[model samples]
Target chain A: MRDLVFRNLRGRPGKTGALVLLVTFLSLTLCGGGLVLSSLRAGLNSLENRLGADVIVMPSKAALKTDLDTLFLQGTIGPYYMNMSTVNKIGRTEGIGRMTTQVFLSSMRASCCSIPIQVIGFDPETDFTVQSWLAQSRQGTLKDGELLVGTKVNVNVGESIKLYNVSCPVAGRLAPTGTGLDTAVYCNLNTIRSLMAAAGALGGYSYINGDPAETISAVYIKAADGVNVDDIVNSINIHVRKVQAVRTRSMVTGVADSLGGVSRTVTVLMVVIWLLIWVILLVAFALLAGERKREFAALRVCGMSRARLSGLVFAEAFCVSAAGAVLGILLSLVLVRSFSSLIEGALGLPFLLPSSGTVAALATVSMLVCLLAGPIASAVSARKLSRVDTGLILREG
Target chain B: MDLKAQNISKRFYRKAGESNYFYAVRETDLELPSGALSVLMGRSGSGKTTLLSMLSGLLSPDTGTVTADGRDLYSMDDRKLSAFRAARISVMPQGRAVLDTLSAWENVFLNARIAGVRDESLVPRALELMERFGIPDLKEALPKELSGGELRRVMLCRSLLLSPEVLMCDEPTGDLDDQNTALVLDSLRDYAHQGHTVLLVTHEADAVSYADRLLQMDAGRISTPDPV
Candidate 1:
């Protein structure tokens, strides 16, 4: 019976169209679904991997906001100045193993291009997280006036790039991290302070005009091995006047939650899209089944078992869906890779390529959908065909 | 095994004004013995095909029992009945009931496979049947490519794939010319000679001449042979 169904499914002309349409539809939906899921997973994973410091001390006012408005939402950052004095104070605190400061110099273009790039200043010797990834690709230590470029950085190695009028050599390029780090340029804190001082920018150190300064914007703290991060943050909040301490885990959760609405919206939209595709395919199958009513009646009188007939219908649908799913997945991969930059430009958000797991899941779902659709449509048509009197038709013919 | 329809009756309702019920086949009793060829002859609207359908177990009578090989046809579950038909009985319905997508050989093997008799040997067997029927070249031809007579022959070959206990054919020779008609009758006669019950429904006298017994149907009842 299974063989019979398979044979009929392969032999039928109408099944070809159904298979093409169903597979095409399912494949497209699956691709979109895979992309969305993969990007979300990659984004979260990157966030987890890049969380180096156990605690971050920013401005208390900025920390209290639910939106992380000062750090991410608005272009304007509040007074989160935990300069040299604050770092020194925190370094001396008991249970503080290490501390480093980072100052975010607003987006600036290199001398080669006009496109703005995010510039971050860090202490190469003290900053462990982002620096380690950079150091792995570096042949040697970063010298004075040298910069480490992220994966997406526009500058080439050995290129002389200017940061606020101070020229620097591009030392090395970081690997793709699927995070904001990919778009950032890492330079020593001294270099940033010197550049800002020469430019006479706001919050710049006047002493950096002749020599490098130790002042910084924000401090990242790592608690001692046995010391709890929560305890350190609480103590810092109590003793440190204006600074804010954020735990690494809580910061990730906060960022994820801040974008919760977008995630939910994307999920809901994907469901709606899939539902719409199902309906469209259902209608198509229904019409196809209707068109083949006479043929179905003929088979019935010819002693074809209902089960075998149903199996044939299912096989036809499955074939169509499988084709569509493969095509859709391939289409999605091409679209995601080729149009990633376009998507980034349009949405002002990174577009991450989906992983193999996502592609496999999409294909499985598409195949199931295709396999299910044929029988449902065929059952409806078969019921109507069964109600027909075969003998009467024979006599009339 | 014999195909029997005992006191079978069927009535359908008329949607328009006056008539409430229309009897398609009423109080019809039939007995088709194994290893015999029987013909059911009737004009248009004479209920010959309906009675044949009831005998074949494809249709259930509203008030009577149809039994084949001592098994009640209407009483069996769908799966059981389907199995019974595929294994014990074969039906060649009205018109060219061949699947348009499958070649003649494929159609033959399809039935054989459904009946659980599929073997690689069935290919040569199918080709032999097609050749014997004078359509040897049609083994690889799809239904849409075949003539009406060719299609009927393919359906006949499919029905005989399992060497069923009973072969119920409705107008098997309706689309054939004189030469093909003779060929089909010879096939039916040969099948009956092999101890398979062959029940044929036809309006043409030439088609029924090969039958060992003849039953005339009119209105909704079969007229007794040598009618009083």
Candidate 2:
């Protein structure tokens, strides 16, 4: 049966090629679109998981919370800083749990990659946000003068990154967060202070105060259990002197809504293309029935049962669709993996390719859909041709 | 096995109107006993092929039964009837009645393959038949690469590959030259002489000398009777 199917496909190259191409198109759209959408969803989930802080308190001049790290990717975004007095004042407020501050500093030059890597300085002892995320890529803590690089950082573990004439050895690499954070570097507060002092000696006072230890950029706060985070944000906005408190949910929700809109548009487009292919396949098979009527009649005369003949047609379709599906999924995998960075940049949102297991599951579904599409379209033609009068068709021909 | 058609007739509904009907084969009784070659002769539109279709169980007669060895062919289910046809009957269709994709050898064994007969056992028989039909060297030739006469001979070899008890040929010599036509008729005669029931439909005069019984049709009925 397998030999028969391949032989028949080889017999009519033009028709078989057209059908296979159509199926490949369907599978590519279904699988490729599905993977991109799933990756976008994964990006959002990763952001929500990593941004564990319910509320972020930053200087009022900071218009966007995520822009704090965006400067690492894009140079022109201005950095804002508030005095440490604001952090202390916000910590003393009610309903605050496990608060930590991250200082933002930038270096004018770095030999790591094209863009100047953003240097984020965090208090190792009181840090609650990044340590948990770092646990996935490496163990232990970030020691002084050692750097924890993001996944996007060209430097690898145990490698040295020259920043501000300070050659910092990379202690570990962080797992991909699929955000602007992936492009940044993290280190202890003492190392950042030295980096700041080094920049200061060079006449690069990119921070608010000349003293790095006295100024902090943002403070991440977690609301205590049974306490509303919104209330904390509202209180910080009103009670704080010059810092604006932003809820992480607001940032995440905006991203989630955009991802949903993009998902819907992609899904609708994929559905339209699939539907068009389905209709074309139906018409193709129906016309094939007409063209191959005499051949089927000949089979009937050869003592082939109606059921057997129909099964033969369906089996041929199944083979072509299977070939098309496997090829399409492979192409999808290549295209999605290769252009992931561009996909992320174009969307201006996080985009992460799904894991191998997740991709396999999606490919299986797409292949199954393509597999069924072929036979279902051909089954109609099969039945129509199988019922044809063998004697009449063969006799006339 | 003896082939019998009892009061068999076929009618086709024309698209001119729902109530209109055209009789392709009228009520008729016929017997094609074992060990004889029967030739059915008719002009175009004479319902010769339609009657052969009913007799071979390819077309269901409107009223009557075609029985082989007292077993009604129409009464059998699709699977059983197909098996019966594969085991007991083989039909040589008109025109280029070969699957274009398969080679000449594959076409020859197509019937045996469809009947689920293993190819290894039929290799000797296929080789012998192809050698007899002078298509042994054309085993690898596709249908398009073969001439019409060679293609017809290949189809004949295909129909004979399974060594069925009943062989039906519809215009087997339609596209053959005189030499090939005479060769085919002689083979059909030889096949019938081997105690196999053979029914052939053709307009060629050379077939008359080879027929053990002659049947004639006109306007969907056995209008003329002749003795061969």
DockQ scores for all predicted structures: 0.35, 0.75
Worst lDDT run of 10 residues, candidate 1 chain A, spans A67-76
- RMSD (Cα, Å) for all candidates, in order, is 5.5, 2.3
* Per-residue C-alpha lDDT of model 2 across residues B48-102, encoded as one tens digit per residue: 8888888998988889999999999999998899889988899887777789999
Question: Of the candidates shown, which would achieve the greatest lDDT relative to the real structure?
Answer: 2
Docking class of 2: medium
Tens digit of per-residue lDDT, candidate 1, span A1-397 = 4555566666765666665665576566656655765665565566566657788777565554432323332223343344567667777667887887787655444443234655667887788766666756876667767888877778898996766666778888876655566766778777766655654553333433332364456677778899988889888888877777778778677656744655677678767877787777767777777666666656656566666566566666666666666677677767766776565344433345556776677667756665565455445655655565555555445
Off-target runs (Cα >4 Å) in candidate 2 are: A65-77, A109-115, A206-208, B13-21, B119-121
Per-residue alpha-carbon lDDT of model 2 for A73-93, expressed as tens digits? 232245788887888899988
Docking class of 1: acceptable
Clashes (N, CA, C under 3 Å) per candidate:
4, 0
Residue-level lDDT tens digits of model 1 in B100-186: 667788777656666667477777777788887788888788888888888888888888777788898888888889888898888
